[model samples]
Target: MTNLSPSDKALVPFVSVDHMMQLVHSIGVEPILIGLADYIEADFKRWELFDKTPRIASHSSEGVIELMPTSDGEVYGFKYVNGHPKNTKEGLQTVTAFGLLADVANGYPVLLSEMTLLTALRTAATSALVAKYLAPKGSTTMAMIGNGAQSEFQSLAMKAIVGIDTVRLYDTDRAATRKAARNLAGMGLKVVECDSAEASMEGAQIITTCTADKQYATILTDNMIGSGVHINAIGGDCPGKTELAPAILERSDIFVEFPPQTRVEGEIQQMAEDHPVTELWQVMSGTAKGRTSADQITLFDSVGFAIEDFSALRYVRDHIKGTKFYHDLDLLADPDDPRDLFGMLKRATPA
Candidate 1:
């Protein structure tokens, strides 16, 4: 028996939660959001080249767990995410995730990273990226209708990527709104804590809803929304969860990530299966229209797609180079002789 060290092929770069936070801090949150938006936009432009599908989801009364997978022919990526809205009552995270990227050529993992923080970042980036195309010109104020774990990230991403200078916040829970207000302090945005959702929407050009109830709840009604505003509805990510009334869907020119997935899991789930909706990728690639009129209502039914996660993973993989934000994880077995895995294991043991 002989001692042997794992080869480079056996090592996968892993970004832990702490390292992710540090990486974010080192690069600055807004800059990372901007970079992620660029990556996501770039991928969306090449949307035709990647494999796409609805995420595989297992639904339970409490929440849903899902696996979102996609590949760009060269690199493959997947994310394991869970959404348990009730977990917050027990002081746990309502949403948490991890993801991996692998080489499609040899099926070896290239990167593994905690996606809880990254999910929040990517979700916000995706929202802002869509808003950039759909939101009205000279849009500077946003009405953020949900103030929970994702509130601050959404606000910052909008400011960083979409150039929103003011954020009006509202939530059912006053404390949550206050928390978001406090967290958003000194972030170079005018933070206004509102008493009601309607008040929050006043003078807002972009309205983003991200409530976390696992039921058919209407956080925004049709009357609450006016013309010439872009609605970013991200909270409705499962079959039973939604944020806007169906009438709002009817009034707005809806945009979605993937029609199949958004129909099953996004705000459009409330609409008829044949209801007209534009695929966002097509809009990004200039094949379709986005916010054609200043007075038209544009709605982005965001359910958080696999391609966005793939983009985030790709961004992290590219930026983490020449930095200490990740560690080499020995996650694979490499035998000197490819067919001698058993012999390699035996050699690893002491006589």
Candidate 2:
């Protein structure tokens, strides 16, 4: 037996929660959000080059755990995420995730990262990116329903990417609304805490719903929504979980990330299986229409896609270079000889 050292291929860069926060603050949150949106938009432009599929989900009575994976012929990425709405009641996160990226050529991991914060950022960026295309021109105010862990990220992303200057917030829990308002106070946007969901929509051009219930519930009614407003519904992400009223879906021209997945997990699930929806990638690539008239209702039915997560992973991988925000983890078992893994383990043991 001899002493040996692992080579570069054995080391993978890892970004922890603390490192992720430092990276965001180092570049500024809004700028990070914008960068993420740019990466997502670029991927959508080349949407045909990547392998796409619905996230594999496991559902229990409490919530869901999902595996979202994708590859672009060269690199592969996947995220392990769980959504347990009841976790918040136990002083835990409603959602938490981690992800990995690998080189397709050799099947070696290049990066590993904590994705709970990244997911929030990417979700917000995706919403704002879609709004840039479908929202009515000159839209400045957004009605934000469900002021929970994701509220501030969504508001800041809209302000940074979509030019929204005002965010009117509402929540079933008044304390949550207050917390969001407090966090968003100095971020260059006018934060309004509303007593009711309807009050939050007053004079708002964009409405974003992001509640965290596992059951079917209507967070918005048909009469409550008027014309010319863009609805960014991101809360309903599983079967039997929805936010907007069926009448609202009937009245709006809906845009979605992936139709097969959205039809199973988004607001469109309430409608018929053949309900028409414009794939957002087609709109981004100029193959489909976005907002045709000022009076038209445009809805972005976002259910969080694997490609968007892949984009976020790519953004982090690119930005973390030459920075101390990541640590090299010896995640792979490498031996001098490819077939000597057992020998390497034996060498690692004390003689």
Candidate 3:
């Protein structure tokens, strides 16, 4: 017996890209990442609180599209994103995304925002957070493979979060690497353009792959990686896309965000069903170890999780409280009389 009428319920606000950027800039990237990491960890620790499911995907000849949905009893969220590798050639982004946040109690959307830029930010932040735990202590140099739209954020996040001051870069397309290097030019990071992946990884403590390939390709071979190197696998985040040689994962201590999802999408998908890999939450919660020895090879298989997007939406909504750029969207409708639903639609039009 609830007395409140459905029409009396409050509407959820919608946030836009301008609002999202303003919020991120206001909160600062480093602080936002720190907060997101904490939120992700807390959510993972209470795994039972969420109704989680693997992302829904629609594959096409060009690329694949995915919808990731999750809920934590009170709030519900989902992201709509597509991966089209040929996009860059057509001057379009390889990925375009938007997401929605809703109230689980009523299944009404509260916020909607573009997730393209936010995805890049959150992915890089997740990489750095994982590296902070798994990489060798005091590691200051990193090798970045596959410099693309994600490259700049990866460079900045590692610099701001993990003290990485130098980035050795390489890509099949040299211009992409140069573009990334140019973007980092006065950002206090020393950029070294290299001829190959091996050259890029030389003497580096962390290696991050952010390539946009849509198929299984070996960007890193076991021979190129030396001892004590942490690999942040960012791209190759789908079923057929893989960056590491199968053997590379075999030689490393692997970690992932969500095992059920990552098993089908992460770089470690090449491994067998029973292959041992630690979930990052375990390390964050002290239930498992991150880097036991400086010489151990560590790999963080990041396939991007729904929780990250949830964290980003929370950040945007909390920070864009008074912004006028975002307006109310009529995604749901309620009538004062349950039997007057058709009348409500007719009433919406002027007579």
Best candidate, lDDT-wise? 2
> Could you give candidate 2's per-residue lDDT for residues 1-351 as a string of tens digits?
464767889999999999999999999999999999999999999999999999999988888899999999999999999999999889999999999999999999999999999999999999999999988888899999999999999999999999999999999999999999999989899999999999999999999999999889999999999999999999999998999999999999999999999999999999999999999999999999999999899999999999999999999999999999999998888888889889898888876
**lDDT scores of the candidates, listed in order:** 0.95, 0.95, 0.83
Candidate 3 lDDT over 238-295, as tens digits, reads 9899999988888899998888999999887888988999988788878889999988
Worst ten in a row by lDDT for model 3: 1-10
How many clashing pairs per prediction, in order?
A: 0, 0, 0
The regions of model 2 sitting more than 4 angstroms off are none
**TM, every model:** 0.98, 0.99, 0.92
Query: Relative to the unseen true structure, what is the C-alpha lDDT of residue 79 in candidate 3, on a scale of 0 to 100?
Result: 93
Candidate 2, which ten residues in sequence have the lowest lDDT sum? Answer: 1-10
What is the lDDT, from 0 to 100, of the residue 17 in candidate 3?
73
Model 3 clashing residue pairs (backbone) = none
